[model samples]
Target chain A: MASMIVTDPSSAAAAVHRLPFARFSNGLISLGRFVGPLHVCSPTTTLPRTLSLRSPRSSRFITASMATEPSAKVIDGKAVAKQIREEIGADVSKLKEAIGVVPGLAVILVGDRKDSATYVRNKKKACESVGINSFEVHLPDDAPEEEVLKFISDFNADPTVHGILVQLPLPSHMNEQNILNAVTIEKDVDGFHPLNIGRLAMRGREPLFVPCTPKGCIELLHRYGVDIKGKRAVVIGRSNIVGMPAALLLQREDATVTIVHSRTKNPEEITRQADIIISAVGQPNMVRGNWIKPGAVIIDVGINPVEDASSPRGYRLVGDVCYEEACEIAAAVTPVPGGVGPMTIAMLLSNTLSSAKRAYNIK
Target chain B: MASMIVTDPSSAAAAVHRLPFARFSNGLISLGRFVGPLHVCSPTTTLPRTLSLRSPRSSRFITASMATEPSAKVIDGKAVAKQIREEIGADVSKLKEAIGVVPGLAVILVGDRKDSATYVRNKKKACESVGINSFEVHLPDDAPEEEVLKFISDFNADPTVHGILVQLPLPSHMNEQNILNAVTIEKDVDGFHPLNIGRLAMRGREPLFVPCTPKGCIELLHRYGVDIKGKRAVVIGRSNIVGMPAALLLQREDATVTIVHSRTKNPEEITRQADIIISAVGQPNMVRGNWIKPGAVIIDVGINPVEDASSPRGYRLVGDVCYEEACEIAAAVTPVPGGVGPMTIAMLLSNTLSSAKRAYNIK
Candidate 1:
């Protein structure tokens, strides 16, 4: 009878340790009788509002092996991104078929940094993939600021272009804010437009496009079933491009988001306590295994080029984390070349598709 | 040797328990030795730039008691605000003296909400106190939207006006965004303008003025030696006025900021882990002592009125936290009326001063 008192394993251990065997058994049986039937029906869950699988389909940009022996579970970014892109592509098709217009994405690339050129190319490819018309306006390295403004004015007046993305790290002399601000907010699909960033930061108002990379990072977490609620998240590097906005995005997700920068004292100690670590510092191997907590989810956004004599290019793409060590300690990890990079372009397409739908008033 | 391990009783027990006892003791002694000798010739301790006092000076509108208590530390809004006003007043004087120009603050107060009127009156008084000429345009409750726009346009073109504030809760019928955005970014002292908000949210860029109340809350924390780096901060409420902006400002301060709104589940459990809690839910006594971590700093921005027959007004101002319980458990807590409310006006004056300085080209 006492042995019957023990119910759950932990409680049973406590009951057995504190009470006589007959008393414990009796308690267990009573507890089991009271709770056993409850498991047959259901655990409470908040039902989805629409029961619609209408989220943007992920687009798989590049396939990288995610399975490892035993240490960490791979968070498959390419697969997730591909699925999102497919969903967005489907929506883009729906909008085009329903309405007479298709979403057009305009890219304004100033100067020719190889990296910037690559991004623009990727964006164009993504646009084509998502059924969005791609428009490119490449200004020379020394184009007049007035010319850029004129282009923006043209796009602002064009009803066909739903989104405009000005490649970042503009020529050193150009006033980036003035140039970015020139884009009509409706077409500022990069979400760099002040109105949109303001809306993203404001409560009750959602941005039409939460900047692609930050959006991608959050999407990765959501698809992976990471519980952001009440979890400590540490974002390293406070670059305008990634870290600061990413922190804001994480805060909206209900994770306590700490942004550690170069000025931060003992960032390692702070980072070690985080359930989630997003490093955008672009410093190779800056986040060591010792800096991470066991079972922490690591998202390395740094795409640093490290010297690799074996490679013909003399450098290979590496991440902020020492990948080998991180894998051993982390519960989940994202690979660099295939992780956040591809997802950003996918999100760009998703945003463009949404912009198209909103412009045409197509559901 | 064992006696050498002298632990300071004031150190948080949690911190002491985490590190080895000997290392903690050795570190303490080393810190003491390092600090003691530096002050022998020069008694003044040099605070780091991060710790520099950016607190606003007191305004002429209201002043609270200057009492220090053990349970709660005064936020000293008056002192901080006074410093800010002095700087602004000086700038205003320079503007007038140099270019036959004076900084003008235009306030648009719509409707006769008693609270709104009081706030407007206080803001006008603040404007005058800082040597800025105050121009007020009051619209009747039933005034047409075009009238408000007309007033905004007038202020926008007025070369004399350096800053503008449109008191909120405009009649339900008016388009708030269109009216607010009418103010030129240079004169948007309240910093609610979309462009200003966008600038605030971006990295490597700053808004001309941050929204006053949130800026004040963050200034209090910065002045009080509470380090935001890597700390868990919970912001209650999600209103554009206070909570959302406060979370953004805190994120800028590098704290792990979590936002809890009406939709959040188990807010108490979330708030309990906060190293710093900013409650602006406008619900009297919504947060109890159990919701706060022991020794956590609290900034209560709520100014709700609860029935109190004992008071002459038949109601008493109560904050989001039950002050009685909060004072006992929290390291520091701001009182309902005297804390954030005064700081807001002070920051407004600070922004006004900044505008005047920029307008007049005064250093």
Candidate 2:
């Protein structure tokens, strides 16, 4: 996987490489509408604490879309993610050879949600691709809080474990914050801990790790050479995992950021002003063509499951954006399945590698 | 100090009352040009970390003005603060009689800077005005970092103490973050700890305490009935105690917030777009008339000193926003010395009272 610069089959590069999103389809697409987004955490999910993008019952805000058009350059997230993985693989090999330490990631998944299981499995595979060791602990939905805490404590104390992640949307019975707080800040590779977030929000301070998907969104922008500084950016949704963190990262990059959420009036008007728009709201086709300013860059973080009779799975993966309309209007836009999804896993791996390097004091 | 609603001599509620800012002339007027703003730190000033509204090596930004030219309604922070302090005092008295828990605030001063010392003195007097017990530990500039740590530990252990405030600019010799972090979160009335800030940033979560000055800025807005929801707010500075937290508080209040700092290009252009402005940059007269949107509500957090030969102190306090210009264009503007400064102490009292209530489990 030497710089798996995936050639977007649809792009000018026309590079033919199997997309990673297909392999992790259920996890990615199921995330947006899984009873609630709370069950599907981030690329490096902490306890799932009811991540919501309140789709109003009225459906008055959404309009029918005409999405067959395509004009914007696709910022293929799959290719970018693979390229990052290849770089990490090389670095991981070197770290292992030089320090006799392979980066190790520990994942704690509570409850037997099949989608979550798929995600955990994909994470393990991705870690192997980068030559990192993986540890997993699966707890029953009925598991007591103490059991989950004991595992977190063990991971924190384990020398081999460089990064710890608690798969989000724990059993409704479990206290999410309590379980997450148990993960020591040093091992909180997910970057969901409040202190890391606080640091992220403060000037002259840095978070140990940025939550994966949001970090991935910024990484995609950087890889594509989008100038964030002084650009007007709008972040749709306010989930701690993606929207809030994404906005913070944009602001840090000097983009004047505005968050458009459930409470926002005329979100379309506010969103139209953005040079860069990152929409994480799970509502499919919610952002109409008129909502986007021409030549704006779009990063679609939503991976909602939409029913499709034409698909064998009975549902297809779609993003918060009306992609066809966005592509025609936007200068560049990321594809939902091939876009932020792959970057999410890629960032999780990157964060794990970073944690390992720091723990070992290996430059 | 019974509900010291310092009658805004300018407002129709003009119940004539001597103003506190006039009493603290050197304190308010000279905040900006007091050689620099670093001399002032608050209950939760983490590090007086080179917090500068650059003097420009030339006082070119300052222009001779007759402050009498007023058009905007003064959001009397002094009156509001006094009013809040009065309520807190009443609460403190009730708690003392009901639970024998007189809210105790412990202030640790690490240096002998006259401005910082004066801030500490005012805090002490403010505590007495509110019937809260006050403890002070004044260490020399050369005192070891451990000395500050020892006092924090003592305060954390002291059952009588409900809050701990570390005066800012920690002598420039000690590690500010290190000392601030040593403060127990429960007693961290200053709310400078990373965890407290972390809690502040997360949704569905609240910090044990919010930083005093920033909290004061929000409180003043609320008291003045400036509806923050959906408003465009731009915070001028990114200092931990003021700018950063002020933005966070505004965002929590549902404002679409932007932060303009030294790195911000075209600051005036951004400032002009704001419906609500909170400037804490500590720059003297940096925000000009063109910078403000007409009819905007301005919260001037920056308290800077400018040369005034007419005054006994030879200088007077002004905010980051030019009062004269803002008053003409703004719907409302906070006066410098009488604005955010008084509110800072008021917030400190509120937090201390809250801590005492929490400690005693009294409603």
Candidate 3:
């Protein structure tokens, strides 16, 4: 189970402004975006006395609390993504009017995996929504590896294309490293190139582009006014795409970072000491309430699907952290379905815009 | 006070098989190497019960202990580096006999900085000691940047040169990044290239060459039989050359690694949790006895020079850890002058040999 956010473009549009709310069996209403004065925590409860009001811009709070069980502030990635798209759209328009150039993104999809195809389609739609040009190539499963390289080569020479993305999970016969390396560093919007990662790891150096998922994770933290410097941050998982880069990013922000992987012993003990935790291990409910500090914030990148007999699809999406348990313990948390998923594509658009600006020598 | 071990070639040859020993005023004889103990420890002292017998091959132990203050086993890096050099020398002879190829390393020294010249001379000497061919090119302080690039290009084309190292702290007029990046990744034995670093940071990917100092730190752990897997490791400082790479290397060995930097708050609290600690920050004696966890293995990479009125040179070398304090607390500790210093040049020789083997396609 990989905790990556690859969502359909249509679903992203539909999920906007939807509040994350939970109703308990004890007749208690837990509103994720509730605001205004109301009954705070009961004095007799063992819950932490200090309530963390994270969203200063939104100014939301819990309306009522019948039970002592506390609720975490929802990160609301979908809403945040909506605002970012709007910002990008306005910038795209201004660039077009001033420089008479539209940012262009080129994507190459090798195989016909349903999820991969959906991601490509969503990416193209996202480009269109932000007034950016999108170029795509669909190759048959049996297509030769050279064919994919040819497309990348052509895109590399194309001045109009600012960003290039190769949809992953290439055919087994294809060498992913060779294909990925073929894309020029300037147009590597996906940022999987080792050069970008190397630059990111070193101090006094800047990567041309940060990986989209991790960038979105940091964006959420920045938007929520979370202080990263001098904080203890624990990142679960050591995956090349997400966890490793996320840890590096946190370290760059001056957060003393530790990564917990499968080989880590007593992970909960180390994780509970963190002021902020980023769980990208994809294991559903692996991070329990006890694994988090009382006021710690959680950004759950996992969107794992567990079997659900009552749901129409026979499965329901869950995050690495137990959402119910996290609400009662953490200061804030990102939901599995509507959280990091939408932000991934939004960051892709932003990267494309930035690349175009650099190409045209525009700020 | 950077802990980088830059020594003169003549001095490297002079300092061999030197044992680390400490004389205490408590009438305690602390011998770094004492095979067959006279007395273990007094039963009244508050110390860890389990004694760490690290050197199985050497079968060395503490010779005498008068007071309750227990002494740590010295890592004996000078002896370890000598062993490694002997192994590398034998391998170089075998490869030459088998394939009729001798490994070669090229050193480019810019400017007249005394320290930089000493490091280059040491590297050349070390290469010769290991039966590898050495090439040297010295440029004046005011040499043009193009001259350096020309030398790099020539070496890049030279089949005899398997590894190319450009001495760092190039003149202020030259761009370090551009000059470092000029050397092809294939011959980047110094391993400062972003591509090499990118590979080192990612999982399932291997860098052509690991940086010398950090590689030596890990080699010390492996030689001493210090367990790394499933252990908690802390790395002080985050410099690209040492601290950062050291943390990544520890992570690769399956140790949960945390990096503490200058901006980190309450560094002692985190450092005390590590089973193994590698201090690379140049600050002299910054990590005191209380900062180390009892029974932890310490690898000190800092070789800082502090003022010493009594010394002939008016200075003395110390490490990031307070040596006297660490000896009483840590299970084992590497000494400043003889610890990681000698190992760096040995690893450089090893990298050059490996590069030659790869180039010739020899097993």
Candidate 4:
């Protein structure tokens, strides 16, 4: 993956001139033309044209002049997510002002998985940041199935709680299906509820809420003006959370999606054909630089820990793809820690808000 | 597609000897040795293979050599479904004998689509055959929303109606989602109900009633000893009825499944890589011989109409894949009208029977 960065002023101007306009909103096209520097336009003449929805946007984006700054361009995921959160906050305030009610999310955490606990805490904080109410329920590691069902029953009965999230990987002894089924369909904020999954798979039908992480990945591409319609998208890994549903969502967006998993032989051959690659395999650096096609938009979903001598924790967070190599090849790449991770909690808050609006007939 | 009949017994025997025996069941291996004439070994050599559980008593089967005499080796779905109905009738009788309760199915038809009406009538006949009561609700094409919801509410409240199926493709004026959502998940035997779809998509989760048609396709392959695990499967079309959910189900079986749809360019190149091809595209003869790999098992789901002057209906049923060409290049193929079509109705009856047993708490 060899990435070209245009840091020169002259190249930016040329890049701005080459941008195709139709796929972009009127405001974005004007913004690029007005704000682009001249040096960045140097690479514009050399960039090849494409048959894509965002081709116009891409043309203006390619400046021949490489970025002089030697330091790696750190993707500011936290900042992007924060901006989205603030917008949502404003929307929440308006919704509340109009309806006299705020969105409420009820999270049920069974057992004591450290990761699950951390995720729940993050969700609650995110909810608070967006002016949504957060409700928490923690059960003992050895809690009876009936007791957990009782909690779901209570949540289902509570009119105030508009959405519910049951932290997954419950105790081995308890029936996870039974507990999950107990959550009312309207309040299933996590979107893991069967009804939601079913709706997602059906054509001419849409899920009330798409799962947060996958939705966030698409949102990132949409915001950055990546064209998906009719592009070949290769999704690596097929877990229920990220891969399978993500592929379905991509297909719905009119992208021809091919899912490759552990069973796939010569995955690289299949991946090389993709205009967009979303690798969610948790394996460290499973996707090499050569595996990616040039100018492809890469979204790395893997959050793995690699041994690091410099870090006190003895490891550092790394994605499924080798970031250093991928940076050079991909036109745009989402960094592991900052990219998809933060957007998930933000989307959860969005779902919670939407859930409340629907429940109370506020919208 | 060009199909060659196995007229040469010796050549057929040679092909049987070359099939991968390491993946075959012990019983099949033993059956292969005793080839007097018309043994199951011949077609088994060409058919797709998958790992499946079966009771020892299920070993009773006719050989492929017997397949030479069409009557001897055909898997009689109509007869089998009749036998199954008789068995269910006995169970229904026992429920009445012991508990004095009858199992019933309520079908709601919102429009006058000829196909939907035929299906509803067939289901009612099947219910009668199995000693289960049938409730039918017919609405005009311009029926109002309240009228449909009222019927759903009444059926949901009635304990007598154990299962419900709202025929699909409602009039354009009607809201399909709202009507389908009204069906109680417990009685959603059609398995289009969102909860069932969700369970089907989730890993390690089993749908209470797998969608009838796709389930029938899998069951046929399983009974015939087609290996699915780790096999490369290409499914054409991604409609909700068959392709999408079928791909999900195949993935659950550990097969690497790729879905090719209308948006898929160079479909032949992708499909040629499949060890098994399941084509549901209704376009007659869309799949050609070159598109299929040698010795791949082809499951043709499309029941298309082709001109046939001699036929009473002025046409004959065809499939997306050309039967003649596919049979010649592929190891085995399912005839369109006879293959998947009959199995679908059989699975419907199976679903209804299961629903009855569950409702009455009968084994």
Candidate 5:
């Protein structure tokens, strides 16, 4: 897959100029929506344009020549996530000072999987960083499913615990849906409940909590100032946690979204038509350079493990996208490790804090 | 809206041959699917084609000479609905004989809008026609919201009540969401339950009951043998009950779907891209002939009251579509009165029967 790759900025720009791609973009992303028309010009002729809508009075536009290098700008997810944490920390402190209460998140981990444990640890650290209290309950893989449900019920009744998240991929012996449904919807920080997802999909309705990973993906796009409304977006893979919800969030932002999976025919053709591409399929380097449209923005949500002899671990992590090739074609792209992963925990903290605020009747 | 209309069979055929309209059509209309590639000859030289996929043994392709006249086919929803009810009646009898079980539907009506009463009456009559038992609780305009809730609680506990539907637009005093939420999700025959809709949007997740009207629209297409896979379908409007769910269903069936709503710009251009169009907006005659592509299959769900004092009723029904114009331009179209309306009730009965079957652990 790596050897068959190629990338060219011109073809991608031409793809963006096509009908539907140009006509469909509503350009109303959450934070950094563009104002006026999207000027389509030769790459060198047009200055890099970024118009941000942080607020009515704070809106800013910047136009600068990018003559130094042709490579795309790296979207810094870590910095954006840190910025969000600062905002959340401020909110958390205000709530604590006014109400004499601190937001608390309870995590239930049922298995001994290394990666799941690592995720739980990271979430705990993130909560502490943002001034939210954290609680943990660990059980062995052989623990009865009822044991997990028991913990959830107790936490639901505990007013101190504003949010409860049962880490996923429970033992194959357990029913995933039943356990997920057991977490009371109000305390469901993971946002895996079907009701929350339903609200997210509908207009004029609000979900109690947006699933963290998809929320993080959208936050990254907003942070980097990508205009989404009416733009053609292709979401690769359709996992419940990331791809599916990500597509729904994009659609809510008014982007014309397509979910391409294994069954979809001419996946590359459809994907190339997108102005924004979000690849969450867990396949390593599955998206080659030619498959991308130049001037497109990419958010890579996939993190896969591949062999690397030089590393002491003998294996290194890579995203679903071929990062090296994507950077050449895309105008903006998120790197694998520092991109969506950090934002997920940040979103979880945000959800937990919001749940606490709601519980205390505080804004 | 009616005077400028023109429908040419030749032009419609030529339009069908242009791109995806022909390729996307599964052509499985109740009659037959096309046997070979559609020949784009002049309408005068060849006969009208009606390909249907009613059954493997019943498949037929007619290349007859349509030399008589040029007009679009009127899809009769009333007749199709009657056919569905007959099938449900047979299944209901079989369930009774085999398990001594009969399907029951419970309807809760608050307040007395004349239109709401008419709809409830029509539903009761339809229930009787299909051998399904109907239960109704009508509350006066001044009834406390709790009275409605009390009735829903009773119906939720009643084992015999296999399905529950609460008539919409309750009195201004009643909290609509609170009352609707009281209906046990298991008996939510209207499929308005958030969980049901959430499941519908997720891949590999099946909704317990698809909302009735949208379900009926899909059934009409299937009964008529419209091939949806790979087709470009546009659903006009984004109401939760009709247009939104319709778009989700179309996407589930492998069609590339676009939802055009009030906020949408250049909606006409997007609508023309569809080989199949389902318009649920109640705006009478909003969809004009030129807004449509030639030879498209249409399912019109709007039932607006239009003044037509020629006879006794003083007013009559119309669809979002300009019926006279659509009949001329479209290859096949559903008329306002006899099209999508009947199918909605039929679907309700179907859902109730399925619920009873599922409850009784019968296929």
Candidate 6:
């Protein structure tokens, strides 16, 4: 029974071989909707006397005609980000005109990794583009943890620095939690502070700043007019930076959110239930067409590198979802490289702008 | 099709008439398995072409004979809490012998609510039973917020006071968030602090303390040897105190957790999918027999006063789950009044003891 449903035959075969039989069976049952015929494939066999009831409207299943035409509205994060930056720039000018103050973002990069350096440079460029001040402190990889803490403390007290972001993947010798905790909650634009997250989780409490990536995902959803309230949302992965917070954000907007992590027994089954799916597991092309509910919104956060002989670079960036397959089945899909990737920095700028507004008591 | 399934025909009729059509239909489709006939009731009609598959093992559905005998193992929270208190007493004596220190809990009561006073008295009695020290400060309802903050500050600085609890529902004039935040994170035995909650939500981080009711729910699961890993668990509430934390705890334990709140369109469907259920919505008998998946574990945190002329007090406490219905369907169930009620203070004492241990650097 588990072997029948396959939107992409090769991927389904691969997945079956990759996952354990129990997990594969559970996942396949949920994928049964992708099969041409809507059979009553009850996944609740383990439970006593439970019947799997299919609604009379099972004709919405993806047919051959629906698969041929790519119809998903692409969520252009790059365009939305540009629009956001312009908005921020306008807000920055207004603030400066009103109170002679410009929002400032502080970046502390401890390591010399090429990727880290590129990210820092991009962030600084983003700040400049948005008419905000950018402050950078590049310390050696082996710099003492105390030095980093001192810089954070200085930034904490600096009135001009509205937001402080510490580039992640600091040297292994440094205590990450200790250093992250040093930034005062007010200046925690990166929103990695436990207090910020705590406030975000609680009802009737507002977080000063939400983490950039998840915040960016929600922003895209809003910009694209995706309904969140009372909808079912599934977040893949449980990383502190992305998956966990994304679920929290979706929940805040009144979604019935379920988080599927590495330990989840049937990720596909759970994910198939979501009206909105946010995949940030860093596993390229893990979410196949069969794993998606037809017309479900997809926010693919993964930016993994896959081999691409045709590209100038040896590898090409791909998201956690199969982009090509998703376009045919989903109502909307965020593309790789240009999707959630660009919106992250935009949210960081937005957070900084809001922080400055908060400091100056601006409406 | 939505009206066929009913464990108790009268209650089902009441539910159908009370709820709106859409919500009732969605809830009833999920409740289909409770009917004598194991018909496939598909809840996915809104979705395009998704088949509702039932496993071949549909014979486990509830039948008349099976419903007569109550077989669920009662999670004796009263007995378990007593055991916990005894264990804490042993630990308190050990800590006192080794460090010449007894754990002390300071509770601040601002109002003259009778229930609040009874709770405080019960807590004090529990602390005494566990060989710990308890300190109480009662303030008038008209007292300034600053006065309460002063007592909290003193408790925070006191070496002997390992735990500080401010009784909730402080005078309406006083800010609850400000007062709750005043208790230092180290001495936040109630675990109501945002930092503690934040730590609890994040992966690879340990909260100094977990909120008592939710912690008690998980402890009951552990004592009864319930397998949480990779299981489907549903938490039926989103309150900051119990429901939210309970879901987080279940997720931490590797359960694929889904939270069904007031806005959830299909609560019964989601609840039926759970291997374990923790309901803290405070709605008496909200979860009926049809909501239970055969052999699922039920932890009902709600203790609501339902009118009962048969009882001397004119009312009897009932849990969110219908107890008789749950016992017939669930493999394990927690009874109201005797269930989670007794475990809250036990967890409070446990937290205070652990706080003292951490303060003294005792293993």
Number of the predicted model whose DockQ against the real structure is largest: 3
Return whichever of 4 and 5 wins on lDDT.
5
Q: Estimate every model's Cα lDDT from 0 to 1.
A: 0.67, 0.71, 0.77, 0.66, 0.70, 0.75
Comparing 1 and 6 by lDDT, which wins?
6
DockQ, each predicted model: 0.25, 0.41, 0.69, 0.42, 0.28, 0.63
Q: Rank the candidates by lDDT, best first.
A: 3, 6, 2, 5, 1, 4
Task: Kindly list the per-residue Cα lDDT of model 2 for residues B1-363, writing each as its tens digit.
Answer: 111222221111111111121211112332322434322221221111111111222312322223334456677888788888889988988887887778899988876676566667777999999999999999999999988899899999999999887876577779987987888899888787777888888888889899887888787777666678877888876667677788888889988787776555567877887888988655656677778776688888665555567878666665666677676677778887687767777887888899988887765
> How good is the docking of model 6, as DockQ?
0.63
**Which tens-of-lDDT digit does each residue in A139-201 have in candidate 2?**
888999999999999999998998888876678889887988899999888788889998898
lDDT of 1: 0.67
In the range B162-222, model 3's lDDT, one tens digit per residue, is 9998876678999988988899999998786878889899988999999888898999998
Q: In model 3, what lDDT does residue B55 have? A: 71
lDDT of 4 by residue, B184-237 (tens): 877777676666877888876778787776776676667655678768888877
TM-score of each: 0.72, 0.80, 0.86, 0.73, 0.79, 0.83
lDDT of 5 by residue, A33-82 (tens): 11221121123322233322232122344333353355676777787788
Candidate 6 residue spans exceeding 4 A from truth: A1-68, B1-68
- What local lDDT does model 5 show for residue B325? 67
Question: Which scores greater on TM-score, model 1 or model 2?
Answer: 2
lDDT per residue as tens, model 4, A149-255: 98889988888898887776688999977887798878877676667888888877778888777777787777666778767899877777777777878888877
All-Cα superposition RMSD per candidate: 18.7, 13.3, 9.0, 14.3, 11.1, 11.3
Write candidate 1's Cα lDDT for B1-363 as tens digits: 111111111111101111211111111111211011111111122111111122233222222232233344556656666766776787778777887777778888888876567667777898888887889999999999999999989988888788887876689999987887788889888777656776776655688888788888887877666678667788876666677778778767767666766545557877887889998755556677777786678998765555556867555666667777676566677886677766777787778777877876765
- Winner on DockQ between 1 and 5 is 5
Task: Locate the minimum summed-lDDT window of 10 residues in model 6 chain B.
Answer: B5-14
Measured with C-alpha atoms, the lDDT of residue B157 in candidate 6 is 95
Ranking by DockQ: 3, 6, 4, 2, 5, 1
